[model samples]
Target: MNRRTLLTGLASLPVLPLFSGFTLAADSPLSAQPPTRLAHPPSYWRDKVSAEAWKVLFEEATERPGSSPLDQFYEPGNYLCAACYLPLFRSEDKYDSGTGWPSFTQPIEGALGTKLDFRLLWPRTEYHCARCGGHQGHVFNDGPAPLGKRWCNNGVALRFVPADQPLPPLRG
Candidate 1:
């Protein structure tokens, strides 16, 4: 289908509300109630992201490998969902796997998730937003140890937040 047709179809889909890190007992960053309502997507969001972006950010579509700006953005910053701004990964957690995507050794504690992705039609592990349920990427056991988890994220799926903002208060 054409890009606009694809985006329009996605925009009509409900935004599956997800919770933040602290809400879940295991710190699932994507735990809000699934979107049960459907409406036209917000104008700002529609304007901010392109139709292609909407597909990846909202529809969980993965881009062809080695084609995302985020895959090369190795700056020290926070990688957040471009759609919801929920913190997903930190620079320190990133690793170079030459997977043509930005690979993280870990996510922001609870900012990721995994499920069976049949896209490749091989039951690969699919990972995504713990909050908005946006598709980030996948995970693989073939990673450096200590965490031994590979969080492969799509470039357009994230917006990097430099460590400019003051840290939030500890949640004790």
Candidate 2:
């Protein structure tokens, strides 16, 4: 290699640790982490969900606002993670956040996990179903009283269970 190229790479070696250290921190046990659960192969999930649901749950793609029928759906029910059928939010917590997605004030205790999302160059609290590690949505500070937290969810990632219907038992 040229002398110039060799020297340039050597100069960058010091900076590499700064970025690699960030990755190590993420893997640290002290980090706020989701509980470990039974894992399935990607093919198993692909066979279970729709193309749209797959994009949102597995690929972390957001669905269009106001596009989900669940946005207008206010019937008494429980909202569940479509991937693992884990009950996440209750019908009583649902509200119109004007963001078009199904907004909730909170989730069932330990039903979800969170991480900081820097996708838009700003950090947002992104949450996922704890049972299956499926992407659900982000939680924001602006919302109704009592919690003032808006759990902005992608409707495609949820399955609504009517109040009269029984939800499937949570998976261990």
Candidate 3:
């Protein structure tokens, strides 16, 4: 099938809903409700993150594949938005897709928002942090069963907090 045909087929599939019984540990960064949206402008994050990270988070630039250490990282932790420190994904949902990026089957419920991107001359679902609106990455249909989602994320746009470490407070 052509790329467009494949994407169209994927788009027609039903998205799995978040589990009603799923719960994070009391100490985990995520809460049952969606994260509170931040009002800060993209410029507000200018000084908080490195230049490369700022590019990915605010400018919506994609990092080189296989360049992110997070792709190989399999530690138990939560991935937070590098721009605003909002928890975006849990370790349990992460997996290696051999795509050279940190891929997840799904994100923390309500942690991200999506929009259609056409920068590559085709439609793709681009997701960003729901709280800070920092661009994370594109979501594809080629993933493991149950969800069939591949949340291919930019490592520069995320900060991994090992389970042993307390999640940092949300930043502007």
Off by over 4 Å in 1: 1-48, 166-172
| Per-candidate alpha-carbon RMSD to the true structure | 10.1, 8.6, 6.5
Every model's TM-score: 0.68, 0.77, 0.81
Model 3 accuracy (lDDT, Cα): 0.82
Q: Model 1, 53: alpha-carbon shift in Å? A: 1.7
Could you give the candidate ranking by lDDT, starting with the highest? 3, 2, 1
Return the number of clashes found in candidate 2.
0
| lDDT (10s digit) by residue, model 2, range 46-74 | 87888899888878899999999999899
Could you give candidate 1's per-residue lDDT for residues 12-90 as a string of tens digits? 6434333331122232333434322223343435565677767886677888899977776777778887766667788
lDDT for predicted candidate 1 compared with the true structure: 0.65
Name the candidate, 1 or 2, with the larger TM-score value: 2
Best-performing candidate as measured by TM-score: 3
lDDT at 96 for candidate 1? 81
Residue-level lDDT tens digits of model 3 in 22-47: 22222223346666667788899999
Q: Write down the lDDT of every candidate, Cα atoms only.
A: 0.65, 0.76, 0.82
**The 10-residue segment with the lowest total lDDT in model 2:** 19-28
Q: Candidate 3: which pairs clash? A: none
